[model samples]
Target: MTDKPHHPLTIDGEPRAFFGRRSGKRLHKGQERLFQDLLPTIEIAYPETTLEP
Candidate 1:
C-alpha cells in the first residue's frame, strides 16, 4: 500500500468544514484494502481534483 493523505469535507450551505488528515505514516495491506473499499461509498468526488505533495 501507498501513503496518501485523505481529507473529508462536509458540504453544508457553503461547503462547511469537517474532518481530514494532517499527516501520517503509511498504511498496511489490510488498512489499504479497507480504505479502498469504503472510500467509494463515503468519499466525495469533485471534478478536476488533484493532489499535490
Candidate 2:
C-alpha cells in the first residue's frame, strides 16, 4: 500500500485550487486593528519597469 499524495485539488469550472478552511472564529479587536493598519504597508505591489528605468 502507498500513502496518498498531498496536493491541492480544484473542482471543475473553478479558476483556482479549492482547499483549506473558508471560515473561522472572528478576529479579536487587536487582530483586526493589526490587519487594517499593517496590511497596506506589508502587501506586495508590482512596480512599472519603464518608470524605474
Candidate 3:
C-alpha cells in the first residue's frame, strides 16, 4: 500500500490557515456567465451597525 500525502492542518501552529490565492485565475465560460447573472442578487449589503471581526 502507498502512503497518503500529508497536508498541514494549520500554519505556524495557528488554528486557521489561508489556502486560497490572492490573484484569481480566469473562470470558465459557464462560470463567468453565472458570476455576471447571479452574483448581484446574492451579494450582501453593509448593515448600519459595525460588525465584529
Candidate 4:
C-alpha cells in the first residue's frame, strides 16, 4: 500500500514513527510573552571558542 504524503515519517510505504511536526506558526500573545521571559535565562551564548571537528 502507498503511504500518505501528509504522513510524518514512513519506511518502505509503511508508517514507521511519529516525530511531531515543528511548524513555526506565529505564537499567540501568552506564548510570545512566555518566550520573551524565558529566552534570556535559557539562551545559549555563541561560541567562546571556535567549533572544531
Candidate 5:
C-alpha cells in the first residue's frame, strides 16, 4: 500500500502549504479580481543586496 493523505486539508493552503491544480486554466471573475486587485497590493520591493556568502 502507498502512503496517502486521508481527509483533505480544507485550509487556504497558505502558512503551511499551497495546494493547487497542476493544470492551468483561464481565471474566472473572482480569480481575475485577485490578480488585478489583491496582487498589486503585495508587490515585492527589490533591493541592491548582494548574494555573497
Candidate 6:
C-alpha cells in the first residue's frame, strides 16, 4: 500500500484506508493513450469560491 495524500474534501483530511488492491493492474497501452488523449477535454477549472475548513 502507498501513503497517499488526502484531498481536502476527504474525511477530516485523513488519508483513505484501503483493504484491497487499489488498482490490480497498470493501465494498458491503449488505455494509457486514451487517458492522455481525453483527460484534458473533460477537465474543469478549480472553483474560485472560498472553501470551508
* Best of the candidates, TM-score: 2
- Give Cα distance to truth, residue 27, candidate 2, Å: 0.4
Q: What count of clashes does model 5 give?
A: 1
After aligning candidate 1 to the native by TM-score, how far in Å is the CA of 16 from where it should be? 19
Q: Candidate 4: lDDT of 12?
A: 62
lDDT of 3 by residue, 1-53 (tens): 21433434454543444468746889999999999999878968898999989
lDDT of 5 by residue, 1-53 (tens): 21435434446632333468646989999999999999989967667896566
Quick one: best lDDT, which candidate?
Answer: 4
Give the TM-score of each candidate: 0.32, 0.42, 0.38, 0.31, 0.36, 0.36
lDDT of 2: 0.65
- For 1-53, candidate 6 gives per-residue lDDT tens digits of 23545423345665555566655688999999888998868867677997677
Off by over 4 Å in 1: 1-21, 43-53
Off by over 4 Å in 5: 1-24
Q: What overall lDDT goes with each candidate model?
A: 0.63, 0.65, 0.68, 0.73, 0.66, 0.66
Q: How displaced is residue 22 in candidate 6, in Å?
A: 2.7
1-53 per-residue lDDT for model 1 (tens digits): 21333434345424345467657899999999989897668966666968666
Which tens-of-lDDT digit does each residue in 1-53 have in candidate 2? 22434543345533455467757899999999988998778966677664554
Taking all chains together, the TM-score of candidate 5 against the true structure is: 0.36
Q: Candidate 1 — what's its lDDT?
A: 0.63
Candidate order by lDDT, highest to lowest?
4, 3, 5, 6, 2, 1
Supply the TM-score for candidate 6. 0.36
Error of 4 at 21 (Å): 7.5
Clashes (backbone N, CA, C under 3 Å), per candidate, total: 0, 0, 0, 0, 1, 0
- Where model 4 places Cα greater than 4 Å from the true spot, the runs are 1-23, 43-53
Output the worst ten-in-a-row residue range by lDDT, candidate 4: 1-10
Model 4 agreement with the true structure over 1-53: per-residue lDDT tens digits:
43566755455666667567657699999999988998767966689899888
